[model samples]
Target: MTTDAVFDSPAVPGVPLPAFVQTLLWAGWPMEFLERAQERYGDVFHIHTLLFGKEVVLAHPEDVKEVFTGDPDQLRAGEANQPLEPLVGPRSVLLLDGPEHLRQRRLLLPPFHGERMLKYAAVMRETTAEDLARWPRGAVFSLHPHMQRVTLDIILRTIFGAEDPRDLTDLRAALSKVLDRLGSAFSTIATIPPLRFHLGGFSPWAIFQREMAAADKLVYARIAKRRAEGPREDVLSLLLSATDEEGKPLTDPELRDELMTLLVAGHETTATMLCWAFDLILSHPAVRDRLVEEVTGAEDPQRLPYLDAVLKEVLRMRPVIPAVGRRLSAPLTLRGRHYPTGTLLVPSSYLVHHNPEVYPDPKVFRPERFLDRKSDPYTFFPFGGGVRRCLGMAFAQFEMKVVLAEVFGRVKLKKARPGPAKVTVRVFTFAPEKGVEVVLEG
Candidate 1:
């Protein structure tokens, strides 16, 4: 759609039409929602619609940061995220806004930081090592599902304790099933009304809610049993004892909501990131060789700087969450461009990461760019910026590095296909479209 043909109006200056927005919403549109705009117009052009109704797209880093920071409250990931709300409940920390968002960030950051996170390092390394051992040499395995399962287990173990690993398995399967449904669910259920009830059977939300309720039973049972005995050192134990401004314990529902939120939001995003990393590495022989050389250089494997760059590169090239959204609280001008309240300003990771000026050779897999390039803080925001930024950032990075180290250190992945293969993205998420088959040789 041309700039003039889009939903631009007198009331909202420089905006596009709703008719153009509806055109993009048709099923199975090639490329992601943002990429389609990038291809049609330059990186800075707009898309008036997506799965979540109407919005504008900004691929530039400065514009992107403006959405995240200057207008954090304006561009939010909200209840409109239908498929996610069920597992996390109505009041997950992920969906909170403004003062509530601040409070949750404070409460959530401590367990995921400094000394507390260090305790999980050994667990991460051990888990990665153990999981990679199961990958048969030359096997055509899908890393996306494997990474999800592993991260699910890691989150469960870190959040709960190792005492009941089976509980983690059940929760993983339950949450995965719900996510799979959402990823596949189309119709009025996905857009328009956001249905919570089904005519013949339980709705998607209902199935997920039942799973969440079952998972909560396990959480509360563990908490009750733990309290009956003594204090423990896990997040569940900490949250059980934590008070919210008022010196009262976190309720069962709140605890369960947070637990479920972390598992679903944290695991899925990171696992998608890792799968992208594998695809990026396997495709480029030189990058793969350097990563392997860096990772395998020590009696004890090292944190290879370039390998870290490779992961950063993958995240940049194929960011799982393509858009970081915020809604306007009070109307304002961003870079002298005015927008109305409730206007959805999307700072697209797809655009920002591929911004040629900020990231030279932005399309290529150059982990070196992150280390070598000069850029602003917002220029590399795989995790969203400002106060509402992801609390699990450190944990996700740690897990990604550990997993990458495990895979690259042990075996070399020879690409199974003859030509270059790219991951196919759906909505905001990206995954290896072919499951990334490769020959894993020792």
Candidate 2:
């Protein structure tokens, strides 16, 4: 089908809301809006919103397949991620398109793959053990912040390779402040085009800029120090020494942007997913019992089938990123309907995971479903699909498995309530609303 075919095909139906109202709905409750849109308009529909101009959402497995397997030149994931520019910076791989994005991806892929990632497994285990040891037993606490701290430490030591305790401490504080600010309601408003204006240092945008500057200083210092100290095993050293096809090493700014992208993307999503996994496992006693038995007895905890299945089920049920978007650079046909260029196509992971036809009893948590059958990329892509899929998928999975194994084997945790934990959007990721309250048992 061609662009001409779009005229014959009816416009994709969606909620008819004014731009501002649509933005309000999106900013307030994105998942709810998507769910409602899916129920009312079917799998393929259009939504006109300020964020992406004109957008199309594809929820069914078939439509999502076309999207994932579409021509890379025609579907630009980087352009679709423009809203993240202010946070990850313009030079980040998440924002760059075409050849530059490919170059950066190639360079950044090695450390997160194969034996290199195996080296980080020890770091993940050690950090989780240390952090969990500090938790007060028999006291009610939110596991979210604890998971965040552990994951942050893992990223710092394994990826950034901050050797100095002082540097690590400083960087942690700055990053925490920046992330907290980003998660605020005012920061969400600051992302809007008209509100992006700076009103001196007091404005939310200005404050964010200041925090970014502080973070940049520490990151640059670390980069410079790593450069002078020669090669090391961490991801930073790998990136510094890496070259493009022309054998050109990454520049300081390029390194900084890539590092920041990894720092944010690497830890935040994993931490949030970890919180969800902990809550899910604790809430389901049978699953918890099975997991503990599997983890404790296994020689290689990472190889435990049930633990892996449990993690997969958690991701399927509660994908940290609800949808992965792509803006069409060329007219395309999706779900037998032609769409014009400049249309934003989003593959809703949330909708796809909960599709009753594909997953029977979708609301119920069942890890055994994974063992029964393997999921195709188009059907079960929590890290996304196609060429732009998340580079840290392996590393994140490994970290999750290792951390869960270590924690479950050592500490006994109990849920504070019998009900499921509430979900909330914390910045870009879905997080537990009350932070997954639990008590460490004696």
Candidate 3:
């Protein structure tokens, strides 16, 4: 639909703002915009923006459940996530639908299985400890960048299986460069058709292409090297050995794209959540003391209920990815209203997480609530829901627990800057404006 046509649509109700204006607001101030829109429009609303076009936002848990549990053939996440093709590649499981999606998902699932997490946990703890040792003492610094480094390092070792010092350093730098390029302002503008054209080497699209190419080159080289070697424990090794129903292993490009998907999907989201965890935890003395006590005293820190509750509360309050989208291919009715085929349905994780009906005193950070009760799948979906849910959910949460145990157990930290960290939109996810500044006191 054209930009002008979005304004005339009576099927969806939303803020009476122009597409350009809405896009600007969404790009600049997503949290405030979403909060205000939900307050005015209630649980359901629409956002007609230049970037996303018209997507109906569902804030109610029941509505979210219906869409999540709806027919995968009818509500397609792959089609809805088309814009990510440039970043993750066309062959990624994230971009595949129906049988193809299931096949790819099955091949990828084994690497992140519960047993495999035990192997990855060692990498996670070691990576966090190594990075924590490097953090400056008696000086204020942003923990966000540090968290990014640790998560990216963990992804490299655990996912890419990079063990050589030279290869690890090289791959880390290349991937970091690609992510930096992706987070640029011009990158968002490059999504628009008219502005997406590459003029020359220095052009925004050209620069992005170059960064991706560099990262892919390093990753492809690692894949080739790993292919020559025998089976190993890392995710890439399993993926290398994995064959579909036809007994055909993944091609080089397919491997590259899936690796890229894991990197893009796992890196920033987990890092941002870590930053928010520290931001939230440090601000609450009682929570911090309790968490530290549990982590420091526990025989196995990962099994502690309070630590898990703290992570859950952090995710509930600050979901890194606010919404998950599904595009309808068949007419469906939601909350008594009929939505036609081609409608975009977004389950707003941020809104549902903060809904007073679902979470009493939603604005407050209380880990005890989670300790007493388990959250409904539709209601607490930081990693999203249904078959399309993130493959790294288990890995990410496990890493969080391991890292939190390591951090709180070894060091004492205090927020360097007063007041809560302001939420800011960074590329596709929400992040702390100041990168969660803090200092080590001990």
Candidate 4:
């Protein structure tokens, strides 16, 4: 699959900025890129970013159907998202194609299933409780950082059966640094291709490499220790027990890559969702009051009505993952447009989530829409769509609801300031730039 399409064409015709300038208009995309492009053009269009140096097609639901579910073989997850492909390594399900993706998904699916996910509810409840217990009453603090810590703990307990909170905390901090640096780094560094030796790309990537080495030493060491300790019911044990169609156990590198994929995918994005949810409810007094009402009468925060709706709406508004990219595996066309194979397409969560056609008054944050009816599942994808949908979606939703439940139920917090005042993306994920600061009154 290949394309002769040159990125020189503007983001859309008659737009003031070149595709390049429009891409660079804001750091790491102010909103989803396609969204800004739609404002400049209309539904169907293109957006450019320096790093990938490619133009991605942005589509509305009518256009997106083809790209997302249209031809699974024809439309593929592309190299535009390749930066992390290396870190996640070759066998990561996220970086695979067709049959390979299916196999990895099949192998990875059982442990993340219904009965299994139910076990995390208690972990979520207890972890959230532990974190909420330390919230200093009347003191303003950034919630996302705390949320990150909480999510990591949940992941450790659920995925690894980890109990030493301090060790997990250290691992989370180190991994957090690596992820935060990669998503949005300074201009020059983010765009460069990697070499065996050369210390620039994605903000002191050498330092990141050092951190990776340090984290790897720790993670792999744990893997060995756990191995000696004998079989357990955690994700690692599950992976060890998994057999491919060929009946082979996952290679060591495969195991590490899988762990990294789950760690990075599950950690930052869910934490961002919580951060955005905290800001969303705190800023909108009505939403907050309603949530308090729904959960107040309930004996447990996790069981409250409208709770999941609230999280979905939060994800819809400020989705943790702002964009997703896929390459053309086979030639395809959509929205009356044609493209050759390997044409890079980027989907904008910002635009799709804000599409007034799909979401009425897209700007307003409302949870009622979800309760009203079933809408197109593909359109409002925070966990992404298709087979590659996050392996941790259930875990993410559970963590968010459980943490929010515990906090809202026990810790009463109010936004310390006014306005969204700058709700934005950090690197690739959406988070408050000023950090969603709030004061806990309970």
Top-TM-score candidate index: 3
Count clashes in each candidate, considering only residues at least 3 apart in sequence or on different chains. Answer: 14, 0, 0, 3
**Candidate 3: tens digits of C-alpha lDDT, residues 300-358:** 66699999999999999999999999988877888786777788889999999998878
Pick the lDDT winner: 3
TM-score order of candidates, best first? 3, 2, 4, 1
Compose the digit string of candidate 2's lDDT tens values, residues 198-308.
887687788778888999999999999999998887999999989989999889999999988998788888888999999889989999999999898566767788998
Local error of candidate 1 at residue 238 (angstroms): 2.7
Task: Spell out the clash pairs found in candidate 2.
Answer: none
**TM-scores of the models, in the order given:** 0.87, 0.94, 0.96, 0.90
TM-score of 1: 0.87
Whole-model lDDT, candidate 3? 0.88
| Winner of 1 and 4 under lDDT | 4
Candidate scoring better on lDDT of 2 and 4:
2
User: Taking the tens digit of each residue's C-alpha lDDT, what string does model 4 give over 1-442?
Assistant: 1464524344333234655776566454476454656776786565555555555556577666656676666667734456666456678887877787778888888888756767678878888888877777788888876787788788777776676767676667667666665555541363356533434543554655676787777677667766788767677778778898899877777777778788877877888788888888888888888887777646655566588788888888887676677787766666556666767876666678888878899988888888866657568877777666678877677677777767776657888897674656555666777668889774
Candidate 2 stretches greater than 4 Å from native: 1-10, 19-30, 48-54
1-442 in candidate 1: lDDT tens per residue?
Answer: 2223233643223324464554444234424555655766655554544465566667666676666666445555553354356557766887777667666666666788855777777777777777777777766666766787778778877876644657656656665665564455442243234566654546654555565566667666766766776666677777767666756566777777787787767877887788777877888888888878878744333246676677777877877886666666666576666766666666777677777877778777777776765546577777877766677887888778877877787777777775445556554566667666666765
lDDT of each: 0.66, 0.84, 0.88, 0.71
